[model samples]
Target chain A: MTVHTQHINMTRTPLPILPISLGVLFLGTAITMPFWGQAYWLHEFVNISCFFIFAMMWNLLAGYGGMVSVGQQAFFGLGGYFVLAMGNLAGVSPFIGIPLAAILTAIMALPLSKLAFRLNGGYFAIGTWVIAEVVRLTVANISIVGGGSGTSLTAFRGVDRVFRQHMTYWIALTCVVATVALILLFLRSKQGLALQAIRDSEVAASSQGVDVIRMKLAVYVVAALGCGLAGALYFASNLRISPDAAFSVNWTAFAIFIVMIGGVGRIEGPIIGTFVFWLINHYLSDYGTWYLIGLGGLAIVMSLYMKDGLAGFIHRKTGKDFLSIKRIYRSK
Target chain B: MLLTVENAHKSYGALAVTKGMSFSVEEGETLGILGPNGAGKTTLFNLISGDVSLDSGIVHFNGQNITTLAPFQRCQSGIGRSYQVPHPFGNMTVFENLITAACFGGQMSEPEAYDVAEEVMNSMGLTSLANQQAGSMTLLNRKRLELARALATRPKLLLLDEIAGGLTEPEAQELVTELKKIKAKGTTMIWIEHVVHALLSIADRLMVVNFGEKLADGEPMSVMNDPEVKRVYMGIEA
Candidate 1:
C-alpha cells in the first residue's frame, strides 16, 4: 500500500499582487463614484455593470459548463417584468424588487430546464430561444402586466431623483462585486474542477462519478439568476419595460459577442470584452447601422484569427493567466 | 464473487453485439478478456459499467443488482473503468484530472482526494507531469493517465480497456510492471487486451469471447491453446 510521497507538494498557483491591487483600486474608485463623479458618469457605470454581469453568466454557462444557450433573454425579460409587477401592482419598492425578481426568475428556470435539457447542442440553443419567445408572447397576453404595450416602473414616484440614482448605482456596483466573488469562489472549489472536467468531456466525467446532468442544471439555474438580476437592474434604471425590449434576442447576442471577443472560458475574458464593448458602443454607436455591421465583422474576424479571444491570446503568447485557476505541484 | 453478469444481451438495429453473455469474477482475481477486433469486448465493458444498457440481463456488483443504475452511480458504488481511447480532461492538469476522479469516484474529501491523487501519480510515474495539461501529453503519458485516473477511484473492481494498445514494446513492458504492482495489492481486475503476452504475464485466468458469446474460459495458457479459441481468434485451421 505504500507509495512515494516524500518530496511532492500540491498547491494552487499563488495569486499575483498586480491584479489584486488594481482590482482594489478600481473598486475603491467605483464605490466613491456617486460622491465625486457626475450623475451621467454614475449612469454609465450602471449600464456597464449590467452588461458585464450578464456577459459573465453567459460565459459561465457556455464557456465553463459547455451549454451554449441562445435563449437566456427569457429569464432576463421575466426579471424586468417581475420587478415592474411587484413595484406597480404590489407596492414593493423597485430597488427591493430587483433581487426578489431575480430569485423568482431563477425558480422559473427549473421547469424550463426540463424542456431545455431534452434538447442538446444546436437544438438546445435554438430550443432556449424558442422558450424565450413563448415566454414573451405569454407575458404579452397578460393584461395585468401591461400586455404587449408593457408598463413603466412607477415606484420611484415619490423618491428624490438624485438619491434614487445614487442608490441604483450602488446597488448595481454591489451586484457586480457579488457576481464576481461568488463565481470566483465557485470556480475555485472542488465542484468547479468537476465542472470544467464535465465541460471537457461529459462521458469521461460521468465515468469518474460526476453527475453530469445535475452539474449542468445547477449551472443553468445560476446563469438564469444572474441574467435575471441584470435585467431587473437594467430596467430599474431606465424606468420602462416592454415585452419586445425586455425579451429581445439582442441581449443574449451582445453578451455572446462580448464573451467571444474577450475569451470564451476564462474569468478575465468577460472583463476585457465588456470594456471593449463599451468603448465601441460609446464611440462607434453614433454610426448606427455601420456600427452594428462593424461589431459583427469584428466578432467574425476575432473568431477566425484569434479564436482564444484577447485573454486567451495573451495566455498563449506569454504563458501567464493573470487570474490563474490552475493548480501547481511543488517538491519539498 | 465480486462481480457477475448474467444473460446479458445487447443489439443495435439487428446487429447483436452481445448475446446472452454471462461471467463472474472472484475477489482478488485478474481476469483477462481476449477476442477479435469486432468481438464485442468494449460493448461488454460498457454493459457492465452501465455506459450501455443491456437489452435483457442482470449485473450484480458486491451482491447488489446494478443493471438499472446510471454510470456515475455505478462508479460511486466502486466500479471504475478506462475507455479504449483515452479521454482525459484535456484542459485540466494531470493532477487535477486525478483529483476529479478521486473526489467523486472515491468519494473522498478535498484533502484526502489530494493525497490519493498524489499517491496515484507517484505510482503511475506521472509525478513529473503533475502540472502538464492532460490534452498536451504524449500518448504514453495519456495512457498512463487513463490507468492512473481509474486507480485514483479506489475501486473494489477495476475494468481496463486496451490500455496498452498503442504503446511500444518497452513502454508496454513498463506499464505491465506498474500493473504488476497494482495486481499485488489484491484488487479485482477485468482487463480487455490484445497484447497476449502482457495479459498472460498477469492474469490468473483468461476468457475468450467472439460474436458476443463466451467461447472459452479457464487457465490462461489452456484457454489460449484451445482449438476453438485458436480457430476463431487466431484464424487458424481447426
Candidate 2:
C-alpha cells in the first residue's frame, strides 16, 4: 500500500525581516501622524480605514465565499447607530461600543441568513440589498436616534479635541489590522477551505462533506461584524450618525471599488484597492460626478479583463501562490 | 456493512425514478450497478447517498438511519461519493480540492489532512497536476480529480455514479484496475456504469434495471444472457 506523504509548509515571508531591519519605518510615521497631519488627512484616514475594513469584508463574502452582496451597508448603518446608542447614551467607551456593535450585527445576521440563503447568484446579491433597505427604514421609524436625521455623539466632544482625534486614529488602525488578521486566519482554517469549496461549486462541495449553508451563515455573520465595526469607527470619528449617511449604499459601492481594483478573493487586493482609490480621490478631490463615472468605468474594465484583480495580476507575473489558500502540504 | 438501502423509492410528481431498490455491501466489496439510460440508476445512487429525498424508503449506513440526513451529514457518516459528471472545485487546484474533502469528510486534523491529500493525489496519479487549477483540467484528469476527492473523504462506502461514462476504453480499463486495487484495500464500493464490458470485468454480480424496475439480476453472464435484459439493451437476445 502506498501511503501519501503530507508535509506542513509553514514558511512566511520571513516575517518582513529585511525592511524592518533596514529601519523603524512605521515608527516614524506613527509618531508624526498625531502631531503634524492636517484635519483633512485625519478625516481621510477615518474613511480610508472604514473603506479598507468594508472592502475586506466584501472580499470575504464575494471574493472568497462568492456571495456578492450589495447590501453590506445595512450593517454599516446599524453598527453606527449601535455605537451612538451605546457610547453616547449608555456612557460606554467608544472602543468598547465598537465591539458591542459587532456582536449586535452578528446576532442580527442570524435570522437574515435563513432568508438570504434561498436566493442564488445574482438574486442573492439583490436580496441582500433589499434586506439592507428594510433595516434602513425600520431604523428611520424609531424616533430615539433622531429618526431620519440621526444623532451626534456630543458627549465625546466634551473631552479634549486632540484626545478624541488620537484615540479615533488608533481605533481605526486596530479595526483594519484585526479584520485583516482574522480573515487571513480563517482562510487558513477548515472553515475557510470549505468556503472556498462552496464558492467553486455548492453541489461538489456538499458531496465532499462541506456544510454549505452553515459555512455561508458563518461568513454572513463574520462579515456583518466587520461592517459593524467599521461603522462604529466611522461614527466615532465624526461624533455624528445620520440614517441617510450611516446607511448610505455608497459604502458598499466604495467597498466594491477597492476589492475590484485590488483583486477579489485576495488578501492584498483590499489594501492595494484602498491605496489606489485614496490616491485617485486625492488627485481628483474636485471633479465631483466625473470621478464616479471614471470609477464605474474602471470596475467594468477590471471585471472583463482582470478576473483575479490586482493580487491576481501580480501572482500571474510572479508565479507565486501568494493569494491561494493551499494547504501546508508535506515533503517526500 | 458500510451501507444498506431498503425500499428506496423516488417519484418526480407522477414519474418514478427509483422504485423500491434495495442493496447492501460489506467493507471493501466493489458493487456495480448497471442499467439502461432511463433505468433510475443515478437516481438510485442519489437516494442512498442522501442527495435526493426518498418518497418511501429507509437508508441505513454503518448501522445508522440516514434517510433524513443532509447530504453533507451523510458524507460525515463515512459516505463519500462522486457525481456522474465530474464536478471538481473549478477555482481550486487538484490538491486543494482533495484537502477540502479530507478536512471535512475524513475528519483529519490539519497536518493529517495535508498528508492524506498528498497521498490521495499520488494514489490517483495526480501528483504532478496537484498545482493545476481544477477548472482547466482535461476530461480524463477531471474524472480522476473527482475520484481523488471522494477518496480523500475516506468514506467507508464510496458511491460512484457513471464515473466511467466518457472515458476511453483503455482509460475505463485502467479505472477498473484501479477499482480492483482500491477494493483490495478494504473500501466498500458501489459503481454505476454504462460500459457493460468494463463493469463485467470487475463486478462480483450484475443486475439489469429497466424503467425504474429490476429487469434481470444474478450472475453476470446469466443476467447478460437474459432475453428481457437483451430486449431492453440492444433489442436482440444472443
Candidate 3:
C-alpha cells in the first residue's frame, strides 16, 4: 500500500499557457472592436453572445444536471419585463436595471422550482413550459409594462445612440467571458462532481451522501440566473420589450438546437453551436420556412449520426478537449 | 452496541416486506445473515441505512436516535452501504466515484478524499482500473469498485449486500481474504450472503431471518444447525 501510494496521485491538469495567452490576445482585440469595427458586426456579436450564454445555461441544466427544462424563457421574459418596470416605474437606468432584473428573476426561480420539481422526466419539461406561459400571461395583464403589446425601454431614450450601442456591446462581451469562466470553475469544483453524479444516478449519488435534491435546485436557480441575464442584456440592445418577443418559445428552441448540434455536455458545445447557428441564421434566415426546416433536419441528422454532437465528434477524432474539466490520476 | 434496530417495520401497501424486525450489532463484530429469497434481508439493510424509511420503529447508531435522518445523513453519521447490485456512477471513472464517497460520505476535504481514494484503490487491487469508466468494467470489477467506494467512506459500520453473490469459488475466496483485512482493522460489518461457506469463514456470529423475523442468532455453527433455520432457510423438513 505504501509503495502504491507513492506512485499514484489524482490531479486536474492545469490550463496550458498557450490557450491562456491566445485567449487574452483575442479578448484584447475584441474589447477594442468599437474603434475599428462596423456597428453591424457589433450587433451580430451581441446577438451571438446572447445565444451562447443562454445555450450554455441550458447545457448546464440538461446536459450536466439531468434537468430538461423547456420553460426557461419564463425567466427570460421576466428579466425583460423587470428591466422595463425598473426604468418605467422606478426611473432606474436600464443599465442598472438589467443586473437587478436578473437577480429578481433568480429569486423567482426558487418558488417556481417548488412547483416544477413535482414533475419528472418528460413531465418536467412540459411543466416548465406551462410555468413560463403562466408567467407570460400574468405579465401581459399588467398594463404598466404595456400588457401584451409591450413597450419601449424609455430609460435609454436620453442616452446617446452610439454610446448605448458601445456599452451594450461591451456588456455582452463581458457576459460571455464571465459565463464561460464561471461555468468552467463550477464544473471543476466538488459540487460540479456531485451534480454530474446525480445526473448519472440519483439513487447512487444519494447513497454516496450527495444531497441530490439540494444540488438539483441549486443548478435550476443558476440556470435561471443565466437565462435572465441573457434576456435582460438582449432587450437592452434591441431597445424593446413585449410579451411575445420576451417570452417567445423560439428562444428555448434555438438554445436547444444550438446545444444539440454543438454537444450537450461539453462547454465548447454551446460556443461552437452558437457560431454554427449564427452562420445559418445570417445566411439563410431570408428563406423563412425553409430555414426553419433546414434547422430541424440538421438537428435530426446531428442526433442520429453524432449522438454526442460536434464537439464530441471533434474530441473523438482529435483526442483532445479544447476546454477540458476532467480530472485524471497521475503517477509520480 | 454500535448499531440497533428495534421493531423496524416497513411495507408497500398490503405487502409487508419488513415486519417488526429488530437486531443489534456490537462494535467490531461481523454478523452474517442467512435468508431465503424473500426473507426481507435486503429490506432490513435499507431500513438501517435509511434508503427505505421505517413505517414505525427506532434506529440507534452510536447511541443516537437516527430514525428520521436521510440516507445521506445516515452515511454522514458513520454508516456506509454497498448495493445488492453494484451501483457505480456509470460515466465517471472509478477514482472519481471513490473521491465522491470519501468527500461527501466521509466529509473529507478534496485533498484528504483523494489520498483516501488512492489508498482504497490500491488496497482493493483497483489501482490499474482507476481511470476506467465504472460502467465499462466487468461484473467482478464493478463489485470490487462498489466495496471500494463503501470503504472510502471510512465508515464505523459497513453494510454489504451480497458482495459475493455471483463470484466463482476462487473469486469468492479472494474477496474473503480482502474482507479479512478490513475486519482486522476492527470495522463493524453486517454482511448478507447466500455463500454459506464464505460466511462461515469470517462471520463472528450468524443470523437467520425469515419473513422479516429473526429465526435464530448465535455462534455460527449452532445458528446454522438450528432446526428452525434449516427448515426455513436450508429447506430441510423439520
Candidate 4:
C-alpha cells in the first residue's frame, strides 16, 4: 500500500519590490516639481490632480458600487459654492472650507442617494442629471453667492502669487494621495469585498448576508465626499466659481471619458486615463472642435476593442496589476 | 422544529403563487418537495428565505418568528439557500464567493471565513477549481459552487431550489454522494427538486405541492404511490 499526502499552499505574496521602488522614484520627482519645474507645470499638476481625484471617486461609485451616476457634478458644484460662500461671507479660509464642504456634501448625499437610488440603469443616469440641473438653477437664483453672475474666491487675495501657487499645488498633491490611499485601504478590507459582491449581484450579496442598502449608501456618500473635495480645491486654485462652470455636466463627461479609457474597475485605470486625457487636451486644445471630435473617436475605438480600458489591456498582455485587490492561491 | 411555515400566502397582482400553504421540518431532517411547473415550490423557498414578502401568516425558524426579517437578516439568522439558476459573483473566484458567504452569512471573521471557505470547497469537491472565475465555469461546477457557497453560510437549515435540474445522471449521482455526506453531518435541509430519484435517495419525508397547495405529504415511497400525486404528475384523474 502507498500513502499520499496532498498539500495546498495558499499565501498572499509580499508587495513587489520593483513596482514599489519605481512608485517611490516617481513620487520623489513629483514632490520636488515646484523647486525646478516651470510655474505652468505646477498649475497643470494641480488641474490634473483635481481631475484625478474626481475620476477616482466616480470610478469607485460606478465601478465598485454599481451606481453609475452621471450627476457627480452635483456634489462638485455644491463643494465649490460652499467654499465660495465661506470664504466670502464668513471670513473662513478657503482651505478650511474645502474640508468642511466635503462633510456638507456627504450629508447632502444621504438624502440625494434616497432619491437617486430609486431609479436604476438609464433612468438613474437621467435622474441624477435632472437633480444637478435643479441644483444649478437654484444656485443661479441664490443672489447671495453672486447667483448667475458667479463669484471669485477672495480668501487668497492677501497671499502672494508664488505662495498661493505652491500652497495650491501641495494641497492638490495631498488630496490626490489621500484619495488613492483611502480607496486602496478600502478595497483591501472586508467591507470592500462585500461591496464588490454587491456590484456583481445585489441578490447574491444579500443572500450572503451583506447589508446591501447600507453598503451602497456608504459608497455613495464617500464618493460624494471625494468629489466635493476635488471641486472645492479646483475652484480654489482657479480663484473663481460660477454656477455654470461648477454645475456643468462637462465635469461628469470628462470623468466618464477618463474612467472608460483607463478602465472602470481597476484603481490604476483612472491614474493612467487622467494623464492620457490631460496630454490630449494640452496638445490638441489649439485644434478647437477637432480636439473634441478626436477624443470622441478615440473613446469609441477604445470601447469597441478594449472594453476593460487601457489598463485592462495592459493587464491582459503583461499579467501585472499595479493596483489589484484580487487574492491569489497556490497549491503544492 | 428547525423551520416552520404557517399558512403563508403570497400573490403577484393577479396570480396567487402561495395559497396559504403550511409545513414544518425538524432539525437534521431532509424534506423533499416535489411539484409541477409553476406550482409555487421556488416561491415557497423565496418566502422562507425572505426573498418575497408574504401576504399573510408567519415563518418561524429555530422557534423564533422570522416573518419580518429581511433576506439578509434571515441568512444571518441561519437560513441559507441556493437558487434554481446559479447566481455566482461572476467577477469573483469560486473561493471568494464562498468567503463572502462565510464572512457575512456565517458571521465569521476574515481568517475564520477563509478556513470555512476552504473546508466547504474541499467537501463540495471544488478545491481543484478554487481560484477559477465562477462565471467561466461549466454548469456542473457552477451548481457545485452554488451549493458550496450556500453551505459556507453554516446554515442550520439549507433551502435548495432545483439544484439537480440541469445535471447529467452521473453528475447528479456524484452530487447525491456529496449531499449524503453533508446529511451525515446532520444539517437540516428542504430540497425542492424535479429529479424524483435523487430526492428519494436522501429525503426522510416527501411532499407534493400543486397549484400552491399541499397535495400530499408522507414517507418518500408512500407519497410517490399516492393516487393524487400520480394524478398531479400525470395531469389526469387517477
Candidate 5:
C-alpha cells in the first residue's frame, strides 16, 4: 500500500538516495555474475530472489493492507502446477505459462476473496491457510501432474539446457525487481493510502471514505498474481514440479520470516530482510534443527522488541531511511 | 443548508441506541449534539459516517440521500469525521497521515494532495511534527492529527466526536479555537462533546439527547440551562 503523494509542507527529495545505492548494487549483480562468481553464487541468487519475492508478498498483505495471510503459498504451488501442466500436456512454452499463471491466479483470487473476507484478524490468517491446504490436497489427488510424488521437466529439458537455465535465473531476478517496483507504485496510488489507513484502523479509515472491502479485494488479487508468476518462474527453472514442493509452506514460511526480520510497512524492508535472511541461512543451513531453532529465536525476539522488523529497528537506531522508498520519503 | 439526517434508528440487540433521531446542519454552522453517557452521540456519528447502517432513516447531503452509500463513498462525497479515539497510521509521519486522507478523501493528484496535506497540517499546528512518527505523538497532538486528517479531505460536513474529551482546559481551548476557524471557513460541523464549555463557545445551536431521544434543540445557552438537559448530565455524571 505505498502511494507517492506530493505534500505542500515538504517536497519529497528527487529519487530517494537509498535506492540509488541499491540500484548500483543491482547493476553490479548483472555486470559481475559470470566472471566473479561460481555455481554457488548463482544458486544463492535464486534462493535470495525466492525469499525476496515471499517477503514482498507478505508485507503487502499484512503491513499496509492489514491482510495477515498464512497461505500465499497456495498461489506458489498453483503457479508451479499451472506451468507444469501447460508445458507438458498443452504443449505451451514454459515461459508463456508463467504470465499465464499470473493472469489466472488473479482472476481466481476474486472468488477466493469472498471466502477470505468473511473472517477478520487472526481468523482470517488461519482461513487463508485452510484454503491453501485444500488446494494442495486437491492437487495431490490429481495424477495428471504426478500426484503426490511429482515429476521433472526432463521431457522439455531437451528444448535447451543452458538457455533454459539462464531464463530461469532471469525470471527469478525479475520477480525480485518487479515485485518491489509494483508494490511501491501501488502504495503511492489512491488505493494504497486507503489500505494503509485501514491497516491502522478500519473503523476510522472507512469513516474517512476509504473503501476497505474493494481495496482489500484488489490487493488480495494482485498479490496472488505476484505469487503465481513467481511460482511459475520457480518451476520453469527446475524443469520439474511436485505437489509437496510446489505447494510447500516454505514460501509462506520464508516470506513471513524475512518480512518479520526486515520490516513490515516500509517499501525497502523486504529486500533488506531477504538479503539478511539468505546470509543467515547460507551460514547456518549446515546446523540442521539448531538453525531452525535459531530462526525461531530471532522471530520471538523481533516480535517482542522490533515490532517494525529489522529495517524499522535500523531506522529507529540510525534516524535515517537506510532503504527509503524511491521517489518518496526524501522530498524536501 | 448542507446535510440532514431524519428519523435515524440504530440498536444493539435489546438496547436501542439511536431511536428515531433527526437533525440537520447548515453550511458554515457548528451544531453541538449533547447527550448523556450511552445516549447515542457517537452512534449517530457512526451512522452519518457510514460505519453503521440505519435501522430506518434518511441521510441527505447536498440534496441527495446517502443512507445506502458505503463509508468511503460518503467520504468521496465530502463527509469526513474524526474518531473519539484518535486512530492515526502509527508507522507513518504526521504529514503522511494527512496526505493519505487527501489522496483518498478528495481523490487528489499527487502534487495536489501534498499541498493539501501540508496546508492542513500546518493549520492544525502539526508543522514541526510533520516528520514525526504518528504513534509517538502526545494525546493532544494525536487529536490534532485526527482533525488534520479529516480536514485534509476538504470535507463539506465534518463530524467531531469527543475530540476534546481527554484534553486539559487550555488544550481544549486550543482545539475549540481551531474549530472556530474551521467553522468560519464555511464547513458545517456536528460535534459531540463531554466538555460543555467547549461546545458552548462555538456551537450556534445545541441539541440535547438522552436515552436515545432529543430533550432540547436551540441556542447553546438556553439548551445548556434546560432542566431536563441538566438532569440528564447531572444524573449520568453522578
Candidate 6:
C-alpha cells in the first residue's frame, strides 16, 4: 500500500476581482478627470494626492521600518527648494526638476541616516526633528533660492495657467499611484520580510543573517525620495514656495495624524484616513481653532479605541486585506 | 578541529564575563556546557556566535579566522544559535520566522527555503502551529520554535543556549529526544543547560565553567564524577 503525506502551501490572498475592477474603474475616472473636472476639483485632487503620498512614505518608515521620524518635512522642503533652484537658476524645467530633486533628496538621506541612527527610540524622533530645524535655519540664511522669503518657480512662466494646473495634477496623481505600487512591491519582496523581522526583534533578525543597518538605511532613503517628490509636486502646483511654508513641521504632523487615524502598519490605512481628513478640513476649516481642536479630539479617540487605526479595525473584524503582502499557509 | 577558540576574553568594564577561555570541538561532536548562575556560559556562546565581540582572542570556524566577522556574517558562515530567552519574531507566523532564517542564514532560494522550513517545523513537531503568530505560542512551543528557527539555518555547528532551562521534566525529556534525533544526523552542537540529566542523556563530552574559566572537561560521566567538579559545581563532599 502507498501512502501520501500531507503538504502545506503558503500563499498571499488571491487577487480579488472586485477590488481590481473597482481600481480599474477609479483609474479610468482619474485619467478622464481633466476633460470634465473643474479647476477647483483639480486643485482638491492635487492636495489630496500630495498628502496621500506623504502619508504613505511616513507609514513605510515608521510602521514597517520601525523608524518614527518627525523630521521628514526636511526632505519635503528641500525638494521644493531644489525644484525652485533648478527652474529659476539652472534653467531646468520644474517638471524635469521634480524627479532630480527626489533623487538628490535620497542621496542626502544616506548621510542624514548616519547622524539620525545614533539615537534610538524617542531620542531618534527628537534627533530627526532637530536635524529638520537645522536644515530650516541653514536654508533661511542662504540668500539664493530667495532665503526666508522664498521664491516663485519661474519654469512655468511661458506656460498657460490652465495647462500648468493640468500638468501638476497629472504629476500628483502619478506620484500617488507610484508610491502605492512601490510600497506594495517592496513589502512583497524578500527584503520586506527581512525588514519586518528587524521591526519585530533586531537581535533575532541579525541572528537570521539580516543586515539591520543596511535595511534601515534603504527604507530611510526610499521614504525621503517619496517625500521629496511630494514636496516638489506640491510647490509646483502652488506656483510659489517659502522657507516657512515649505519647511513647516505641520507637514509631518498631518502625516502622523493621517497614518494614526488610518492605521500605523497596514497599507490601506492611509488612503482611508486621508479621505476622512480631507472631509473634515473642507467642512470645518471655517471654524478655525475649533476645527484643529475637533481633529485633535478625533485623533485621541481613534488612538484609544482603534489602536491600529480605522483600516486595522476593519481588518480585524473582517479578516480581509485588500493589499495584504503576508503569506497565508494552507494544508494540501 | 571544526571550530577553535584560542584565549577568548571578554570583559564588561570591571566584570570579566569570559576570561581567556580556550576550547575546540570536532566536526560531529556534541559538547555539553554546565555552570552555575552568572558563570558566563551564555557569554561563551555569544563570543563563539559573534553576538558579542571578544575583548581579545581568535575564533576559527572551518579553519577560517572569523573573530572580526559580524553576528549576521557568522550566521551566514554556518554558526547558528538559539537565544536563552527565545526571541522569535513576535508578529510573524512560525513558518515565516523559519523561512526568514532559511532564506537569509542558510542562503536558500525561495522555494528551497519553504521546503527546508517545512521540514524543520515537522522535525521540531511545530507543524500544527505553523500559521500561528509566534508571540501567541506557549513557552514550551516558543522554545521549540527557537530551536526550529536555528535549525532552519542548516548550521554546521549549532549553539543551543539553555534550550532545556525552563521546562518540566517530561517536556525536557521530549526536547532531549528531539535533540538526539539532530545528533544522530551528525550535526555538531554545543549545548548549555542547567538541567544535568537532559545534558547528560545526549552529550558525549561535558565541560563545566565557573568564574569565567573551565573547571572540568572530559567524557560526560567521568566529568560528573570528578572530585574537583563535584567540590566546585555540585557543592558536595569529594
Q: Quote the chain B TM-score of every prediction.
A: 0.99, 0.95, 0.98, 0.98, 0.96, 0.98
Question: Candidate 1 docking: what grade?
Answer: medium
lDDT of 1 by residue, A1-332 (tens): 11224423666667667887998999999899899999998999888888999999999999999999999999989988989999999999988999998999999999999999999999999999999999999999999988999989998999999999999999999999899888887988889988999989999999999999999999999999999999999999989999999999999999999999999989999999999999999988999999999999999999999988999998999998987777676544
- Which 10 residues in a row give candidate 3 chain A its minimum summed lDDT? A1-10
Best by TM-score: 1
Per residue, candidate 4 scores C-alpha lDDT tens digits across B60-161 of 999899999999999999999999999999888888898889999999876777777888888898899988889999999999998998999999999999
* DockQ sort, best first: 2, 1, 5, 6, 4, 3
- Give the DockQ (C-alpha) for candidate 1: 0.58
Deviation in Å, model 6, residue A94 alpha carbon: 1.6
Give the Cα lDDT of each candidate. Answer: 0.92, 0.82, 0.90, 0.89, 0.81, 0.89
Supply candidate 5's per-residue lDDT for B139: 93
Note the DockQ of each predicted structure.
0.58, 0.59, 0.49, 0.51, 0.55, 0.52
lDDT per residue for candidate 3 within A84-149, as digits (tens), equals: 889878899878887888899999999999999999999999999999999999999999889889
Of the two candidates 3 and 6, the one with more favorable lDDT, higher being better, is 3
Q: Candidate 2: give the clashing pairs.
A: A4-B119, A6-A330, A7-A329, A7-A330, A262-A310, B28-B188
Model 5's DockQ score:
0.55
lDDT at residue B232 of model 6 (Cα atoms): 80
Positional deviation of residue B110's Cα in model 6 after best superposition, in angstroms: 0.9
Better of 3 and 4 by DockQ: 4
In angstroms, give how far residue A275 of model 1 lies from its true place: 0.8
Instruction: Report the Cα lDDT for residue B144, model 6.
Output: 97
**DockQ-based class of model 2:** medium
Name the lDDT value of residue B148 in candidate 1: 97
Alpha carbon deviation, residue A94, candidate 1 (Å): 1.3
Q: Model 1, range B1-238, lDDT digits (tens) per residue?
A: 9999999999998999999999999999999999998999999999988999999999999989999999999999999899999999999999999999999999987778888888999999999999899999999999999999999999999999999999999999999999899889988999999999999999999999999999999999999889999999999977
Off by over 4 Å in 5: A1-9, A31-36, A189-191, A326-332, B236-238
